[model samples]
Target chain A: MNASSLPRWIDIGLLPVLNLIAALTVAGVIIAIIGENPFVAMGVMIKGAFVYDGALGYTLFYTTNFIFTGLAVAVAFHAMLFNIGGEGQAMIGGLGVGLVVLFLDSVLPPLLVVILAVPAAAAFGAVWGVIPGWLQARRGSHIVITTIMFNFIASSIMVWLLAGMLMAPGQMSPETRSFADGINLPLVYEVLQMAGFSVSRSPLNLSFVIALLACFGVWYLIWRTKLGYIIRATGHSERATIYAGHDPAKIIMLVMAISGALAGMMSLNEILGVQQRVILNFTSGYGFTGIAVALMGRNHPIGIVLASLLFGALYQGGAELDFEFQTITREMVLMIQGLIILFSGALAYLFMPAVVRIYSSLRKPTGSG
Target chain B: MADLWLQFVLTIDATLRVATPLILCAMAGLFSERSGIIDISLEGKMLMSAFAAASMAALTGSPLLGLAGGILVSVALSLIHGFACVTHKGNQVISGLAINILASGLTVTLGIALFAQGGQTPFLNKSERFTDIVLPFAEQAEHVPVLGTIYKEIISGHNLLVWVALFSVIVTGYVVFRTTFGLRLRAVGEKPEAVDSAGGSVSGLRFQAVIIAGVLCGIAGTYLSTAHGAGFIREMAAGKGYIALAALIFGKWRPVPALLACLMFGFMEALAARLQGVEIPVIGNISTDLILVLPYFLTVILLAGFIGKASPPRSIGVPYIKER
Candidate 1:
């Protein structure tokens, strides 16, 4: 049967099912090659990610990082800008927190101090985006190349600074000092208990709340505001936007800065809410995964959140795949991630064009009605 | 006099050895980009082929067969990108990214399955690996003037792949500038709408160009794992494709100038690799990972001035929408 004969639109819940199915197809092949039973490994991953104590908590914890970066990438996609420099932005954002917390830690009260750190990190991340964004808008530089280069620069600069001026005292830790203990996200477990909400363990924290709020804010900005209108307009047709008297260059620069600030928040969230310190190589390909999330979500904020959770499960589960299945390596899980992104981003356009056409045709008369 | 000559000899040798893979990959980018596709997939193709070449060479005990195997696999990956972007009118950047992520996963999976070690192939024996070709004239030519010294040090005593890269550059320059197919390829990149109306198939031309790129990148990957160095390692292409993309843009997609851009970046990387232990005057000792960023930083600097002005082929990233 043709794709059109199936449901014209998948249920929002079913999207994950399709993604999981597609992912498993790729993973199943890899598992077979590795001489492992795909079913047993899948079962173990489920147990590892959900049934085990703290497994689900860690899953949501990982998702907290994803939401920030995913929102960061999604914001850029709203304006047809690809913030390929998210990794660079995160590093600079982390450094911004370090710089701010290092000198300004004692000057301000703890609560206000944490509040101030967020904007400072945003500003620092914006600086990282500014160069590539400027070049892209003014010089016709491709964001893909420039942003990739920016990541290298940020990582280099971080390594240089950490080894010299930024190294923590007695820090036998190659990382910065733990954030002043006063700066902390209240233990999620305590916060939940204080509210009289009971659970196995608290994985949801202040940053998780912030991540959800950021998604709502981004959604509002993109769909409900004049600036958002301009962004959507430019993404659709730059020439048309210029014809309408909006400056495309300024829009690109502004949109990219906003995107970078969102990503920079990943650093603040992780450092203040969890890690309490900035370290080299602290990011675990979260920025790169954000690209995958944003694309699979079709640049929708809510869609990105769901995609992040799925990946969160994969990452948490994949971490235990080695223990559960002797033959299954972590690399097999990566194959699943790659396949999902491949089908969603590039292959999807080809995959269901006929269905999309049919659905649109069916709606045209009703929309006109 | 002897010291100065010796220094000169070493510099020339270093330049050629470093420039080989860069040249090959840049040539690959030159073909794909010249035909209107912005091939960010070159990175993925190079990476996957490097893994394939190394693994096959170790398994089969034949370097030549390994080289062929690498080319075939890369071509398959490149063709998928070509089909998606050129045929489906899908976003090129997204498709390129998908291929890259796919390569990363597949290579790692293959590596772990075969080697059972962290995403790395086994080290090769000398019999299975490509060794340096010692020219008969290399030792004999040491008696001549500066020319003999240059030959003995730089030109004569290296892997045959280095010679292939040098020859490939000249041949690529010839094919791009002089051939009818190259003219059609350039025409399509410059104005695909016109080419399409003129009875040339845009998709076909783009596919041909991408395959050319894949083949060159395949050779470059094989060289990286099998010839110049030994055995495939994880993510060994390590931003070389992006550097080659920068080189293509810096050279305005011309073959010879593109070769120069590759050499410049390659030279910088080689210097960084060599300077791992030596302390910089003020900075003191730096980690090799930190030094690796130097080429990327240089790319940004070069792009800020020169790349902004370089005119890309007009139809570079756009899909050829017959209706639009």
Candidate 2:
């Protein structure tokens, strides 16, 4: 039984679900080893992430960041480029947002400042992304190595800028001054209250809407556009893409640019909507987590959405675990996440051989009958 | 002139200390990449080793035991990576990334579980660490100028692991360039099928290379915790592993050149650390961030062919599937 012989639904959906189960089962064992009931932990996590009023909003807030980063990674995956520099690109994007807001906040209206900030962020991210793309295309430098290097360079750049030029005047921390109230993006709770829904206040903001739109945009671009066709072709085989009269280098650059832009947009959620100020290490590990999300999602936009939600639940629930349990700390949450990544990614097909055999056996009788 | 000499000596001393881990990591990367297994998990392996070494040193008050524990953990990780990628034919990069993520999380989790100092091990005493060894008659040597000063300043005082790290480079060079194992390892990386056809086991060679990487990275991690610092801190390896990867590439996967690259990075780092509060003629108090970014920028430049071309192993990152 071959991978291709598996039904599309099983290939796309069932396997991922099974992998999720495997990951969770492993996580359950770890929790058990920590002297905690896995079932109680799971229940607490699920309730904390979704069931409670304000918890949903917090979950969505995290989901928004993942959506952008996952999409970024997914787009790059289409071109066979591993943009591990999403963390760096997003950091630089936040810098762009910081520069734009710092200079334009007092000068322009809040609406116009936000309108300008989006493109500024995306453009900075695209530049950062394209450098490695250009290096790969022109110099034959491996994209993975260059991008990883860029992450460190980006960190140093952020630290330098935040501490020197962008620091709040007279402040010591590596963060910028807060934006004016008028310049701050409205929260989702505030917007919902305006609509009379009485939602709990959380950090969820307008960026969630942008994240959704970006997802749809990515789906349309990747599935419906000629450029995406070329990108996918290049990913399939550069020689085949070249035979088809497409420039693989151009496709690589374009794919990387779009991917970087998507990664950059994550700062809209972190900086403009939530913090209202640029800070050091604001991207946290969202950029790297995107790799796991993309892998689990199989690099499909719809799958990415589901994967993002799942991770968002984990993030929120993990926080709850830290707060509620004495034994299960935040690091334990990371351990669980790492286990999930390992199973879903490195061991993605660990169960596939068995599943394929089962499917073949089921179909054999059906066909004969 | 004396002040200049003192400054140079201090920079060289700092560079040696800083470059120790990088040298080990680059050699580790060289072994892995040469054998066609892209080991991005160098960081993870080092981190896990650092944590294990620190914890063991703290527990037993024996740096040697800590070093052994570190090596054991890293070898286990290396075997896991080999099992996944070499045996199951998993994605090499993904396996590496998964190891990294696992190490990042497990180290912290285990730290909290054991000592509960928010993911930090207790500091080791001087006796429990690989203390710096001073040369005999160093005070007498300091009385002499030039060569004696050089001996006193640059060569006399360094931890045993620093000497071990330096010696490992020569050993790595000889093993990689002069031995039958080196030839087979290189052959497996570039053309595994040819090696396999010639009665060499590709998986076996690759697994051995990975084990070598594990041992080297383990020593690097132990050096970080036991010799370079008092104990383990969260993410102490930081991006040094990645930097080592970059150095490996910049050196074109060669041991000597990679060691040079590591030294260059170490110098840049030493400069960055030393430049604090210092005013230059035109730059006038250069930002540490810019200085910090210099090594990566240099790596990028070197990788982009401004310095030299970096040709990776032909079959690197490709899983070797036995065609039966």
User: Best candidate per DockQ, number?
Assistant: 2
TM-score of model 1 relative to the true fold?
0.92
Q: Give the least accurate 10-residue stretch of model 1 chain A, judged by summed lDDT.
A: A8-17
lDDT of 1 by residue, A1-369 (tens): 344354635423344356557767777877777787788888888887888887887788778778888888888887788788888898898888888887777788778878878887788888888788888898777777789889878988888788657788886656877777688666677776789977667445677788888899999999999889999999999997899899999999998898888888778666776777788877667787788788777678888888888778888888888786555666666667777766676665554555446656886798841
Which lDDT tens digits does candidate 1 get at residues B1-324? 998678656865787777787888889988888888888887889899998999999999999988998899889988988988888876777778777777887898788778876888888878777788877788878988888887788777788778888898898898888998888999988998888898889999999998988999888888889987788888888777877777777776888888887777777666676676877689887676665676677667666666346677888888888854
TM-scores (chain A) of the candidates: 0.89, 0.98
Docking class of 1: medium
Candidates in order have lDDT scores of 0.80, 0.89
Please provide the root mean square deviation of candidate 2 (C-alpha atoms, Å).
1.6
Using alpha carbons, what is the TM-score of model 2? 0.97
lDDT of 1 at A236: 93
Superposed Cα RMSD, model 1: 3.4
What is candidate 2's CAPRI-style docking category based on DockQ? medium
Off by over 4 Å in 1: A1-20, A169-174, A193-204, A243-245, A354-369, B1-8, B140-145, B279-291, B305-308
